[model samples]
Target: MFVLTMYVMLLTLDDYKPTYQDRLATPGMMIRPKGNALEISYNSEDTESWDLYVQALDNFLAPYNESQQIMNNKDCTPNTYFIQEDAGEIRNNPKRSCQFNRTVLGNCSGINDRYYGYPDGQPCVLIKLNRVIGMLPGKDDQSPYVTCGAKVNYSQPLVAVKFLNVTYNADINVECKINSLAIANPTSDRDKFAGRVSFKLRINKN
Candidate 1:
């Protein structure tokens, strides 16, 4: 009876399918540099301070290069769904995903500007969304976009704070919100960072 029961239970299980799925509707966001705290502090003129950030961005973008996508992934129709059917197994695992080249970032591609605008005081921060299984995001054909706003604006006049006598130093609190028709931005305290991320940026001249 034990041997017969074991054989019957094995037939019901699948190798590729998971028993449970993530119930969360919104995915977490991540940023580059990966500091211990939610702060990005670096000197504008100091190359050593920001070199690690540049290297981290370069390494993360290696797999998204045009050459890499051409060799590994297939080119699918733009602004359309890519439905791939699982064919019979072969010697090599062929391409099943659509091509996503780093060139899509244009100036932020890090091709022409290898430093990623770090030396020029305009630092580039890369944001990534966590992957979810069997998740079809966005309502229409339009893609998702990220929008960021700053708590303090230097362009506008401020009566509370003055920088007339201060040296070259800037500290700004910024928040980035990810917008999508399918994704939900909860207002509750527990789910405050559901589809958004906040970080402090500090740049010093010394």
Candidate 2:
């Protein structure tokens, strides 16, 4: 009688970074207060209704806080993607991620006012791009920036309301597009949010 034995082996990187990515969809923009539906509705007079929105922004920004960033990440040159050729590891570390200081957000950072403008009916909506490994955004000297405008009038709309009037409720349709030469803007309805995002903002006093 003859017997045969076979051994199988799977190879992976030492740093655990994916050797190959099979993602079909491109990186897209995302907004807070996420749900099955993409709509932001809040009562201006009710603090309870908008406090959660402020909490969401605070939770989202916790990692980007100044103290947290000082420990783990290092600053890189602005307006340019930092390319490190060393797969060889740095100071016994496999990789070092760039730090995005929360202070860069300025007034929206939730540093000075913890309300994040939500209580005043001037909520700060946080929009961010999904990260893709080994992806280079923009081309030449042109950098990628997110441009948002009102969908109805096709112009920038005022996002703040000093006080809510019972007779007038602010309702605005907004669309944000990521502008970059390296990105593809899909025209099909199926791929509507490919390089852009759209949502409605409704602030009511009642």
Candidate 3:
């Protein structure tokens, strides 16, 4: 049985100190990690509605409910998102709010910048797909049979790129689906095998 799991964690370039770029460390400025750590698990019998990434989103930002729910949570998406929904909110709240006058979220001027851990609102993230313990779906037939990145856009963020394709994908938005990916159910949503690939997201400052 081949199972795929993904890590969803938050880190600053100075704190996490990953072996690669810090892109995979955070999904977006709005989304936070559960206990500052999270992951997505899947196999073949999952459903599209049962999105793995969405589930992770809930877990990651579970502690910061007040603002996370209001500004970033899908449930609160229906209503208007105020830059000051929780202006005075601190510690487990949206770190970015013009009303709050907080630089904890970094520099809003960098918003949309191709850098992670930046206060820029561009929502850049880093991903480190660890080596799968077992054989991947479509892997080489040699000793080092490993896995690679897969197609999980059905639940991935709005714009995922600089890795395989260019930074283009209108679908990624504030819907909270920006950081999640659809479950990999066999046949129906059988995207990529999470077991084989381990890569860091590429950030192009251009």
Candidate 4:
């Protein structure tokens, strides 16, 4: 009887499928800048580990032409803006918890990129900024808190290594795990949901 019972239980287990609960951050969720960096961590008493993804659309372009050329000796104002329109906002609120299994990270789509297979990619976190912040490069001898080059249309999203951090699980999927992401500044008009970002890892010698 014991042997027969064990076999039946095994069959039941094989038919089981995992049920995941997705989460979203509430509006007005605070995301403040810290010195040269801004970051967030994942915490849930019950939720298990999950994956993170970003996909800067194949056609993401900065809304403005503010980025100017760097003169040989003089300093030029950064074309990038620290705050973005489509992006959420920036406020100094106590750190909040992350939503679980939620694919959409930001308030709008332009910047809330989930993921899609692409050969060329960069490491980034799919997140929603309360406000779309511009790349306010570091001035003087200070290394740019966050820096990016000329805006390239339909190009991979940029990463500001000195500016963002994800500290829940140290081991992250670069395709999903990253130390930086390029958040472009808009000098013009934009749609409601328009930006996206994605990251990729070199698997083989392809």
Report how far off residue 110 is in candidate 2 (Å).
Answer: 0.5
Candidate 1 regions off by >4 Å? 1-17, 86-95, 150-168, 185-188
Residue 176 local lDDT, model 2: 72
Q: Mind giving the per-residue lDDT tens digits that candidate 2 earns over 1-206?
A: 12222222133334446667756345566666552367777887898777777788778889988889888887877666766575464434456677777666655667876886666666666666666677677678765666675211111111221222322376677677767766665223566666667777778876
Q: Write the per-residue lDDT of candidate 3 for residues 105-144, one digit (tens) a residue.
A: 2221122231322212133222223322221323232211
Model 2 error, position 68 (Å): 0.8
Which model is ahead, 1 or 3, in terms of lDDT? 1
Winner by lDDT between candidate 2 and candidate 1: 1
lDDT of all predictions: 0.63, 0.61, 0.26, 0.25
Model 1 lowest lDDT segment of ten: 154-163
The residue-by-residue lDDT of candidate 1 on 60-113, one tens digit each, is: 889989999998888988767776556666323342678877766545568877
Q: Select the stronger candidate by TM-score from 2 and 3.
A: 2
Residue 78 alpha-carbon offset, candidate 1, angstroms: 0.9
Residue pairs clashing in model 1 are none
RMSD of 2: 6.2
Worst 10 residues of 2 by lDDT: 152-161
User: What TM-scores do the predictions have?
Assistant: 0.75, 0.76, 0.18, 0.19
Best by lDDT: 1
Q: In model 1, what is the error at residue 66, expressed in angstroms?
A: 1.3
